[model samples]
Target: MTTPTRARAARRTACAAALLLAVTALPTSTAAATDAASHVEGQLPSGATYMMDVPAAWNGTVLLFSHGYTPAGAPNPAQNGPDAATKALLLDRGYALIGSSYATTGWAVTDAVPDQLATLSVFTDRFGEARRTIAWGRSYGGLVTTAIAERDADRIDGSLSLCGLVHGGVANWNNTLDPVFALKALLAPDADIPLTGLPDQAAATSAANALTAEVDSAQSTAAGRARIALAAALHNIPVWNQPTQERPAADDWDAQQANQYQAVKGLLQIAAFHRRQEAEVRAGGNMSWNTGVDYARLLGRSSVRKEVTELYRKAGLSLRADLATLNRAPRISADPGAVDWMSRTSSFTGKLTKPQLSVHTIGDALVPVQTESALKRAVTAAGSSSLLRQGYVDNAGHCTFSPAEQLAALHTLEDRLTTGKWRGTDADSLNSRAAAADPTTPARYVPYRPTPYLRPYDLAHHSDGQ
Candidate 1:
């Protein structure tokens, strides 16, 4: 089977494992309840560390937080909430918070699911069971939370994913591969840059440094910048990078390309290469392939095609020539074993039985906003659209949500769990809610509908054609 069958394959693998070790869910007990505020920390059999915060009031609800990616060799701190401000608010409101720092970092979805389940076990075993368990995650953790919602429906009540890579790992790596691959063919075709099969983290850094030099050099000329725009377009990466500035006007091609160039420099050095190397190591081999892709067809579907075209015309360069270069470049191949492993461990079925609400910033570059679009398609395919609601905040940066905006999304999910129907999820309603709740911070919720996901895997309800 092709990539389309990954969801079914993953679900089957998850179910078989679920049968081996039961997820412990206990009945709530007044006898086990504690009166005062408390904190608990412990390590699981896998050496994964977990931390929990219980409020004084004990509201009988627990919020499970799954954190984003932590690159290898960096400090992997355990998080009890998305941010400090959010953590304080949740605890002050009588909600218990808990999270785990998984066994290993970087592309850890294989360990994340079981680590989360074990954390829940530790929580329930110590205190009584929570009356309602809501699972929330940010970035990569958001992917983990959704996977849990799909497989452990009986344990988790609802979910909230913030700035998540919800399109799953395979699609993310493959999509990112496109732009960097194009960058190699156009900017530094003769340079010894290994786009894939990076042997170690050091090799990945070396490759990123090489590409970084190429991007810096390309920024000097209009022709080179136009080529860069074409690559960013193919990746569907947004061209807005700065947090203090407003999004560039649609007609401002130079500003957009400038943003793309700046944004892409860091992306290539960090996420595009570092994460790929780690993932390939964990998956036992390369998991991305670009063997038969058509570059022009992808550009034809991109949202920034006009921007790219206008920039190329102004630079007196042939857009078609760059496209030809990318098409003729040798393609990367995926290992069958690694592909199968990542599919079962890192991909999502979107077969959710629990209610979930996901929110994304419309201007996100690190984890592109279009991931939400891909997720909705996957959920709909599993016949779970009725249980899913999505919201958008007008902002930039990855997981750069304010306390107010974050709380607003959380409250909406709570309302859904209470009402059993989605209401007031529109931008106006959410903006009003954010302002009413936290008047100090600014609210930027806006109506948004993401464009077609350029690398959507299996969101169509019926077949692999999507």
Candidate 2:
């Protein structure tokens, strides 16, 4: 999943940045600084357990990072992956590193915060005295981070959400733009209907036959395509069909179970299902891997609601037979009723008066740029747009900070937090202007500039600002 070359490059970049920052901030003849390594493990309020690492020369500041959904019993990916990179970056700067498992993976939100706070409480006791603390997360971790920020503003000094799903239940309840996934969601859940143990050939044959029939009966219309497109966007994947994209296998279906423990995995499972389905179709085999079936089955129903005109049209099927089934929507977990949690209350970006900065990639495939956009809008809506600074990089990936500009952005964030300064970009300016007039208006995001660095560089030679 990672390589030595990339890790080396990241380390060099972070080290150089830390050095520059230290050179400017530290006394020329600095006093001896003590460096120690320690860790703490405990249970969270939500009845979950977590672990954290604190540097010995800690400055009483903490940076708590979160992990997204992963396979059950999987090693915490954040600690060794980006968490290592982040720790190497901040630990040298005198910040204690902390991380927690969110109760169980998938979508379990019940114990998410209690678990995190529990970790924080243990840290406060272990480290003794803290002046500053901030929360940060990626993907589902982002959602967790946001939820924490919303309810525990007093505890969190600042927050950074990266490629996370902040919108909550909306994206899940909806169907994908891919017609196959939409059809798959129409499946009815049955305890007796064993799928995983079936021979691949047999399952493929059954799924393919069902899918083909639906396709033949679908109402091919422009509105139908638009509906499908929306579904695809929700899943963060491209539409499937004539091009033959793959969907994940049956067991992978476990991830799509959105019931608290597997929400993140469920999303990944959906992606895998689509990829596999595409592969199978391309290979001229049965089309058994269907998202529509998974979604419907989860909700305990066999078909989509008739009021879903857009879906029927997109499927391009003869709707006459299923119209009656459609009149009464299937009782499924994917139903809008099952996902009312997102709309229960409008989430605020919180009091934006504090110095804040957001960094994002223009081409991130997983978390759309829209998450940041919504956040910016919320801040602007609160008339605190001036307090936020945003940075975008064209070629970076998730939580990725590769370009010289991104390095500069981190410096900018550090400066704002410690010095109470604020910076602006064209995108930030545009967002501010839009929000000034209508606080409730949505945030408009601009992509990053596209340009390759002209320098032939090594980590030692790289320096943007810090």
Candidate 3:
């Protein structure tokens, strides 16, 4: 069979292995109650209970996962789906799996970590008694995992941040600015108006929503969606195929890759820059042209806090609105644009000083593999470069690894955590398996087209046949 066919087959085999292992992993104590292996419910913190699987004779290596963020009504907001699949895979190998619904639903980090820890504490009290703990989080969860590692290193043994938002603050972390501008740049001819002007919270949201809505509309038409998806595929191919330094914003991305511990100098450089900027702003500085600072002032911290506080109230996320007030400042922005700008190499590089492993699809559109490099850098900087490892998968969606590749990567991580060994990137295994899956057919490399027809990047950026 072709490489793609082989890859798909390997993935299937991996999934089968995980399932088989899960079947045999039930604790002897609960073997008779195998059906009870999963005890799920809502509880303390936010009453956001979870579904979990506890294995027999556990190795005491607990993997706590933090789910990625999506809008409130996202189609498949089920953290349990991936959690269950992963738990079964790991449980069979003598590990326990636990997932927490972060303290809040939105992207704000103020209390998200604390609430997650508290929930973890609850999980520990009830099921796991492991002294060794590893945290795994994706996207938003990845950011929270780093923050937790920074503050509660004593409680965490290691961290695996995947497709995490390592960019500073909530604003820059979301890539609000680039997505808008990129879309505008690419779709200007088709767009009624150029998507520019100051970042008015209302206007920005309106524009994004409008664009997203259009994409959604076009998505209903197979031909249109197919064309748009093709364009997206083309945009990512270059990043995957090009050398790291040759990629867009390579310096920014490389800075992100330097380990936090080893790169104290770099961290200090950026931190000092942030501090200097803060001072200037406090001294009546002009907000940089990039921040759209004037527009930011309109919604500012106070307004965002109120909005988020109320969102928390509605979502049952356990965080105090008073905390928002206490933390409010001009520098404190939750705006997606601001967050994305700052996230490049701020909090993670300075604060994260622990051994960690990160994996990402080279072609990820949301959280670029570049961010994963940043996490690896922080680990290396911490002087524990030996303790960290990275794996890149080919022809994969954001975090969707082919079965064999996923298994190999996880095995590598397990080996590191258990024995402190290093194996080079597992990209080869994944590529091999992916190739095998459908030697003739490609895996899903294209993104979904916008239904209503929003802007997308140009074909020059990626590899799909435009």
**Which digits, one per residue and each the tens of the lDDT, describe model 1 over residues 382-431?**
78788888888877778888888888888888888889888879988888
Model 1 root-mean-square deviation = 9.5
Candidate 1 residue-wise lDDT at 90: 78
lDDT of each: 0.82, 0.43, 0.43
Which candidate has the top score in lDDT? 1
- lDDT per residue, candidate 3, 320-386, as tens digits? 3322322231222233343233332225443444566666666455444545444544454555566
lDDT of 2 by residue, 1-466 (tens): 2254554555466457752111011222222122345555665655466666666566666767766655334554223113444456555656677777766644444456667766776666544436667776666666677667666766777766555654432332232222334333433222122222223444544554544443333224433333333233333331111112233233332111111112222232443333233323322332222222332222222111222333445456544434323324342222232223333322344345455556565434345444555456455556767776655544323444432332244345555677665644466654554354334424444555322111111111221100
Clashes of each: 0, 55, 70
Q: After superposition, how far is residue 225 of candidate 2 from its true place, in Å?
A: 12
Candidate 2 vs candidate 3: the TM-score winner is 3
- Tell me the lDDT of model 2 at 72: 37
Q: Rate residue 182 of model 3 by lDDT.
A: 28
Top TM-score: which candidate number?
Answer: 1
Sort by TM-score, best first: what order?
Answer: 1, 3, 2
